[model samples]
Target: MLLISRENRELLRIIEEQKPSSLKELEAATGRKRSNLYRTLSTMAQYGIVDLVRSNKRVKPVVKATSFQVEFGLDEPSQHEKRRS
Candidate 1:
């Protein structure tokens, strides 16, 4: 199973629902700093769950996945759990 953190999920929700045109707008919507949001969004990009589009000097975050599912796992903890430990 692959699980996203609660905060990341909220970020995705804002991106999908609000469709902010730039990171600045997203920051305003989420009440998070641009620097921290950029780091978090960058990580989500690595998972192909979000796309960061750059135009001129602005970066826009687009949500690629709105929902996620679980697959059977042997014994290993999910990435989300591992991060907690």
Candidate 2:
């Protein structure tokens, strides 16, 4: 199961509520340092959960999903389950 940390959830909320146009704006909205926000946003971007658009010298974070659902033990075989012969 994938886990969305509390901090990441807050970041998503900030993006959805404020719709910041740049990293600086997001920093202001979230009260987080730009450098830290950049790193976290970068990681989120890689996971396709967030989009970081680069224009001129600014990177804007866009929220793709305000919330997510996780399913556990659905895709994986249980320990007691055995391979089919």
Candidate 3:
């Protein structure tokens, strides 16, 4: 999933610092539209970057991951090839 972006990073920061109780509160804190925040947070939730908790009939966003590590090697054999061998 494409999770690294300026807007997403900012949203993470806000969630970490403000700790808003619900999406509406987050919308106010970030001055972003509710629809936009919902879409973005939904995507983040799917990627396990954040958690959407339902409390008191409100959806709250919680940051589950604070950092990321990416590793790739071109010299490594493909998984399909290794399995065949």
Candidate 4:
């Protein structure tokens, strides 16, 4: 799943603003199901976007990144490469 998807962006916003203490509280705050939230958050955790901390037997979601940087290029060679070729 893309980290910058609309749903994920919204989830990041909620986590940053509300700072819910548990998954249940996050579920209520976002109006999303526990299963779905867990799945999404787990994925985000894997990407270093958020951290799922265990406290008092509850998992707390913490935002680690609020912005993203994307860089891409076509398969064609660059001007410098063409010059060398």
State which candidate has the highest TM-score: 4
Q: What does the lDDT come to for candidate 4?
A: 0.92
Best candidate, lDDT-wise? 4
CA lDDT, every model vs. true structure? 0.88, 0.84, 0.90, 0.92
For candidate 2, write residues 1-22 as lDDT tens digits. Answer: 1237887787888898889999
Counting clashing residue pairs in each candidate, in order, gives 0, 0, 0, 0
Compute each candidate's TM-score over C-alphas: 0.77, 0.75, 0.77, 0.80
- Tens digits of per-residue lDDT, candidate 3, 1-85, equal 3567887899999999999999999999999998888889899888899999998889999999999887899999999999999
Residue 25 shift from truth in candidate 2, angstroms: 0.7
Ranking by lDDT: 4, 3, 1, 2
Question: What clash pairs does model 4 have?
Answer: none
Model 2 alpha-carbon miss at residue 72, Å: 4.9
Model 2, position 62, has a per-residue lDDT of 95
Q: Residue by residue across 1-85, what tens digits does model 4's lDDT show? A: 7668998899999999999999999999989998899999999899899999998889999999999887888988999999997
- For candidate 2, give the lDDT of residue 54: 95
Cα miss at 66, model 1 (Å)?
A: 0.9
Model 2 gets an lDDT of 0.84
TM-score of 4: 0.80
